[model samples]
Target chain A: MKQIEIGHGSGGRLTRDLIKNIFLKYINSEELDPLEDAAILNLRHQRTAFTTDSYVIRPLFFPGGDIGKLSVCGTVNDLVVSGAVPRYVSLGFIIEEGFSLESLEQIAKSIGEAAKDAGIRIVTGDTKVVEKNKCDGMYINTSGIGEVMRAMPLSNISDGDAIIITGTVGDHGTSIALAREEFSIEAGVQSDCAALHDLLTPLFETDGIKWMRDPTRGGLATVLVELSESLGYGVHLYEDRVPVREDVRFISDMLGYDPLYLANEGKAIVITSGESANKVLEILKRHPLGNNAALIGKVSSKCKGVRLKTRIGGERLLDMLEEDMLPRIC
Target chain B: MIKTQDIINHIRSLVPGDRKVRIMNVCGSHEHTIAFSGMRSLMPEHIELIPGPGCPVCVCPESDIIHAITLSRRADVILVTYGDMLRVPSKDGSIRAQGRNYKMITSPSEAIRIATANPEKKIVFFSIGFETTTAPTAAILETGVPDNLYILSSHRLTPTIMEVLVKDAEIGIDGFIAPGHVSAIVGSNAWNVFSEIYGIPTVVAGFAADNLMLGIAEILGQLKNGKIRTGNVYAGVVRPEGNIQAQNIMAKFFEVADVNWRGIGYIPESGLELRDEYSARDARKVFGLKEIKEEKIPGCICGKVILGKAYPTDCKLFKRACTPKSPAGPCMVSMEGSCNIWYKTN
Candidate 1:
């Protein structure tokens, strides 16, 4: 019998397989066909974007944010990147027995503040107490709904479309890895965990925008690969044009990780027409969350998959992550 | 301070358009830089960069991995090893696939911590790597580990394997890019025999794209001048004498001995084993484990690939029956393994 492995939850190929072979087999629906972060629904009087996410990150508290804040922002950003104005969310918590009440209150306070900043309300909630050892400290799940502002379709992507990123990548994943204290290296990196509605909402007014995605678990590389595969177009990325913090780069190097595949909580990859690329970048640069926005690459019709042009004038192919990146022995 | 592009241009100018120069890199990081940075596309058509046996996990003896899997199966034993080693396939399957009680650690010190935490369990630390990792494992042993912790060492010597490659007539490697991390501990002078006796140009290189290109340029420069010698382009970290304290620590804890590689048979003094004095802390001795008969995975060309005789694509099972997700061989398992790196960038 085939058993589930850790890679299945890594948001890579195995995760896609599990979703396809198991989840989609029983719950087939056209709404889930696109597999976008959030599903678009036609309500009685308005169109809506709905998304749900769970936060089970270890060390509940990290450098820049906590799991409470992450859950709210993660769900809110799912709607924001889907071209929607986030409205309300429902929060649920599963707490382990003997978990400290003070920690719970602190996390609750963080959730309140994050929701407030994102301009979303926690309209409903639920709680469950699991026996000790049945769960980690706590797990939070959030489902968010928003009003669709503009429809950004993958079908709109065309040849010569420019790909832009909101800011530096890998900050959130790198910070989480460091916070685990698995490695003895120290750096001043922080999690880029913030809602992107405030930063990305301006792009809704712009024209010629093709698609948008928050590069979270599988990272910018996976998102691009997925986009290319779905649209039958190719992506060419300039390695030097992709912005990464020096500290994040140092940690990833020491730990044998590729920053391109590392998670970014506050970054959104925007694909737009080449003509409007500079204008989109200008709008992104005006916001604090997108101050490091850059035009990293463009969509192409010549190649079959993602290709990266290195800083030293070499080119290579990039594939979807297969498994969790492990540290080398030497 | 030189620009990477300038180094690339210099390499282009240095290479002869007609002659085929084969340069081999004996470090996984160097290959990682080359593949990840797409350095092969930048090189002249005549110059070929071959990835040698740089990945320690790919060459870790199948017998040792089987022993680790056996030990990890015991309810009272906890097998701790480097994260990459957990995925290496053997006759009985990988430690990750066959065992329930195992932990992946990034450093040797984490083994001691795990031992302290699980006082009642037998913590077998499966230490494997080159001199760079061996020195740290030796350092951890010197500082003292808990009574419950035992070591299962499969550490290989880098220079000895390079010597084997030099003597082999079939693999005609014209130049060498020595591993910088190994040189940092064993000293850059360790590779002098290849340059002095074998008359092959060797340059110690770091993992950066520019440093590697500079190393390649130096190798071509040596070939052009007919004055080949062991050169150091990663001079900022690697020194001629290397880290003396690390050498001393390794000498204190380990002694060189004949050991079997995964695909290659036994090579004399190519591996390090714990001294007899530390037999009590040796997991093999304490557990009375013997090296099992080695078996090769059918249709896997890892043996040829590790020796630089074949490319990963040359293998029939590369992307078909074998892949990073379900690696049928050791080479496809570890990130440092050439097949894995090649598969990623291909």
Candidate 2:
């Protein structure tokens, strides 16, 4: 019998397979399209974006944010990237029997503060305490609902569309990795986990916005690869143009992790027409969360898969992440 | 401050337009730079950059992996190794396939820490790598490991494999881009025989695009002048004599022995074994481990792929039966392996 491995939850090829072979196989609904971050449903003549995400990050308290904050931001960003104005979230906690009550309270406080900051409300909540070792300290599941303010369909994406990123990539993944204290090397890198609703709200007003995705789990490369495969178009990314922090670059290089494949929390990959590219970039840069925003790539019909233009002016194809990022043996 | 463009242009100007020059890199990082940067696409069609036996994990003997898996299954033992080694498949299945009792570590020191933490458990550190990683493993041993900590060394010498590649007539390697990090320990002097005896142009290169391009240009320059010599373009880190202290430490701990490489038969003096003096801390000795006959997964050309005899695409199973998600061969398991890099970038 095939058993589940850790890679299945790594948001790579295995995760895609698990969703396809199991989740999508049984849970058949037109609204349950796995390609989009959130489900778009029409309820009482109103289009609503519904998304749910679970947080099971180890060392729940990391450099920049804790599990509470991450739980709120992750789900909110999903709706935001789906062209929705996130308004309500239902938080569910699966706490281990021996989890510290003080830590639980602290997490609850963080969730409230984060929800307030994102302009969303925790309208409903549920809690369950499991036996020790049944859960890893605690796991938070948040299902978010938001009004679909705009419909940015993938059909609008075409050849020559611009791919813009809101900020630097890999901060969250790097910070979390360091927080685990696996490698002794220390650097002052923090997670970039934050809600993207405020920062991305302005882009909704702009014209030619094709689609947007929060490059969270599998990072920017996976998002683009999925986009290319789904649209049957090509994504040409200028690798050097993709914004990466100096510390992120150093840590990733030292650890044999690619910054392009590392997870980013407060980032959105926006696909827009070439004519509106400059405007989208300008709007992103104006937000504090998007100070490092950049026009990284463009869509093209010349190729079928995602291709990267390296700094040395060479081109290479990029595939969706297949496994968890492991440190290379020299 | 050499621009990549200038180096490319220089290489273009130096190469004889009609000649076929096959340069092989015996380091995973070098192949990674070449594949990741799409350097092959930038090069002339006549110039083929082949990835050689650079991935230590890919070439790691199946017997050692099987032994490690068996040791990991023991109730009193804990198997620890580099993360890259977990997914490599043998007839018995990968260490990861067993799922429990094995811990992935990034450095050798973590083995000591784990050993120290769990005094009751027999901590078997399944150490595997080339000289770059071996130096650190040797250093950790010199520092004195805990009583419970044992080492299962699958360390292979890089220069020895490179020698095997050159001796293989079918591969036809015209030049070599020697591994940068390995040379930092083994030194550029270690690769002298390639240039001096074999008359193959060799250049030690760092993993940067411009630096690699400079190395390529130097090789082309030597080919054009018929003056084959080993050159060091990564002088910023790799020294001619290397870290003498590291070499001395390695010499103190390990003795060269004939080791079996997966897909390839035993190569003389190609592997490092723990000395008799350290037998007490050798997992193979402590656990009375026996080597099982190595079995190759059918239709997997990982052996040919590692020796640069064939490309990943040449394998009928490539991307069809073997992939990173479900690697049928060792080459497809590690990110540093040529097949894995090819799969990711191609």
- What tens-digit string does per-residue lDDT give for candidate 2 at A1-330? 243444544568865775565434322334444445544544452889999998888888988889989999999999999999997777777777666655665676788678879988665555555676777788889999998888898898989999999999999889988888677878899989999999998888889898999988778998888899999879899999999999999999888788898888889999999999998888888889988999999999988898899988999998887665732100
lDDT for each candidate structure: 0.87, 0.86
Chain B TM-score by candidate, in order shown: 0.98, 0.98
Which residue pairs in candidate 2 collide?
Answer: none
What does TM-score give for chain A of every model? 0.85, 0.85
Q: What is candidate 1's lDDT per residue for A190-282, written digit by digit as tens?
A: 999999999988899898787899998878898999998998879999999999999998889877788998888899999999999999999
Tens-digit lDDT track of model 1 for B87-172: 88887888999978999998989999999999999999999999989999999999988999999999999999999998887888
The best candidate by lDDT is 1
Model 1 lDDT on a 0 to 1 scale: 0.87
Which portions of model 1 show Cα errors greater than 4 Å? A1-45, A97-101, A181-188, A324-330, B72-80, B99-125, B137-151, B243-256, B274-288
